[model samples]
Target: MGKPTGFIEYDRIPSPVRDPLTRTRDWNEYSLPMPVVDLQIQAARCMDCGVPFCHTGEEIKNGVSGCPLHNLIPEWNDAVYRGEWREALDLLLKTNNFPEFTGRVCPAPCEGSCTVAISEPAVGIKSIEKAIIDRGFEEGWIQAQAPQKRTGKRIAIIGSGPAGLACADQLNKAAHNVTVFEKSDRIGGLLMYGIPTMKLEKDSINRRVNLMAEEGVEFVTNIEAGKDIPMAQLKAEYDSVVLATGAGNARDVKLPGRDAKGIHFAVDYLTQSIKDNLDNGGVQTLSAEGKNVIVIGGGDTGADCVATALRQGAKSIYQFGLRDKLPDLRAIQNPWPQYPKVFQMDYAHSEAEAVYGADPRQYLVNSTEFIKNEKGELTGLRTIDVDHVDAERNLVEVPNSEKIWDAEIVLIAIGFAGATPSIFKDFKVAKTNRHTIEAAKGFYRTDVEGIFACGDARYGQSLVVTAINEGREAAREVDFYLMGETFLP
Candidate 1:
């Protein structure tokens, strides 16, 4: 530890973000960098606990407790505190393939499980992480480091999201020739499209993708496997195929007027919004401007929709979550070291409240039907309040509690079901009941030989850090399969 009693001397100070009211006017990133001194002070708060659960990366109950990437948190914190910026960056890159991505968007479960959090506020681990990576870039410490030797094996990776990118980076580092395929016009699947620019700017993604390209990894955009290119063709050309396509098949709501205009899935809405912003100079083809937008779901995606709508000048905004409101403090069931299910205002919520003078979230409400006019354009929706029943936490709609609200646009942000089933039609690989690829526990190999699945395609929807872990591990497995020896770590 850089400073043994530093935790006692320093208080937690998070990195500042752009003002909610002012930041909504533009599509730029909202997070502002913390000063080096303040960041170092925050890092000093990392206690020298013998058992640091911050990087345990385990799932307790239904939620992940720590960083899924198993980041060396304390080590990097010590390095940062000692003003060894290069050393901190080195330690960070050893575990996380894309700290810039996870540091921005990942809901830091690492902080939740921090031993310091048991007493005081948790260390600003995510902020420190972003600082280290950002500094690495500014100082030119991060650059293309192509493998000195080649293994002479050709690898084709489907999907260019975090998982696919991480897998490609590792396999390329192991000296294998790797090519990544993406269906979109750009490389990053979720990072490029699904997330709004105010959270993670697209330039960050492009910067990393450029570095990877310079390192000898080939990127093929506007190419989708099982469509323009068949699985059979890839299998014949490449020594092995790794499926890193993310889970983006949105869960549709079956209700009256679901086919109505102005109703869209969250992923589709977000993807289109970002694309329009990039291509059409902020004139969104599918604009939410002046419309009373209703977002049906509660999570980061739904919040993103709310934030995007705000930037597009939405007249009114409302987000409905089926679950009950979380408590202000951790519940008894949610013990220490578990990711706390507590109430906290996310950035989007803050922005919405700044504009609307209220949080805009309605909890414990389930949508019943989408109200629409004869022209089949969404007008609003009906919902009923639900109450929790028994220890099992089953939901029961409260009688005579139906309500309706005025809305012109509806975005379904419920969640993704899993990978697109159509992609697997040609592969003939087994799929789970949940629609994910049927890979063995702790292994990425599919029933079909020479093919493997990882990331959201294998584990369903997960965090960016988890997807990176899946990609790195799958690369190790593929390396072992190709050369009968594994060196990727």
Candidate 2:
């Protein structure tokens, strides 16, 4: 242990963020770097408990309990606390293929399960993880090391998101000829488009992609599977095929005037906004400027829309959620080692509040209809307050709670349904009731031999860390299938 009593001596301090008011003007990252000494102190605060549930990576009650990647938390905390920067990086890379991505975007269930958090605040695990990887890059400790030999077995990955990238990296390291095909013009599917720039910078993704290219992972962009190349052709050409295509079928709000001119899916809006920022000269195809925006559904995506609309100079913003606000502390049913159900404002919510003088979220509200003008342009929405009236948590509208909200533009930010079915029509993979590929949990194989599935396509929408884990384990299974035995870990 770094320090037996360090957890008692030091209280948890979160990583500092940029001022909400000031950061709203630009499209830069919200996080600022912590001094090395401060980071070491934070690292020393790790409890290093005997069980260390922080890295257990268990699923409890439909939610993940710990780091899905099973990161070496205690070991790396000790290395960082001792000022062994290179050793910390090595320990971190042993399990995670892309710490840089997960460190920034993951919700950090590890902190929720931290032993220190049972009573006090948890250690800044996510911040420290980001620092370790960032420092590795700055100190020139990270470099490409291509495999020494090739097995001459060809493999094709159908997506270039986290899962596809992780699977490609692992398979390449195992001396297999791996190729990742992306439908988009650039790599990093959700990372490139679904996320806003303030949360995760595009350069960080590009840097990792470049490193992977140097390490002999071939990335093919602007080429979609089952479109440009037939799935049958791909199956015949490659020795193995792994489907990592993400869940693109977004869940939508099917209310009145759903096809109104200004109504759009949250992912479509975010994708266009990001593409304009990157490809065009910041000329938004779907600008929210000077319009009253209403975001239906509350989650990370909805918060991102609020922040994006703020930056784009929206007149007013509001986010509607079907559930009530979370409690200040964990509820009675929520125990330790399970993800805490508590209230905390994310970065976007804080920024919106700073600009609008109040929290932009309205809890326990549901949109009943979308009001539109004669030209078929959205003008407003009809909503009603709802409540969980039974043990099943079914939403029931409150009496006399009908209201009208002014909104020139509306974005549906509900979660995804599953993978787009049309893309896999040629492959003919069976699907589960959840609309995801029919792969038994843990065994990524489809019914068809030599074909497999993983990540969001297999498990439905989940965390980036979980996608990476799926990719790693899928690679292990594929290696075993090909070589009769395997050594991947």
Which candidate number would show the highest lDDT if scored against the true structure? 1
Clashing pairs in 1: none
Give per-model CA RMSD: 0.9, 0.9
lDDT of 1 by residue, 290-341 (tens): 9999999989899999999999999999999998889999999998999999
Q: Residue 369 deviation, candidate 1, in Å? A: 1.1
Q: Which lDDT tens digits does candidate 2 get at residues 202-279?
A: 999999999989989899999889889888899899989999999999997887789889998998999888888898
Report lDDT (CA) for all predictions: 0.92, 0.91
Q: How much does candidate 2 score in TM-score?
A: 0.99
TM-score of each: 0.99, 0.99
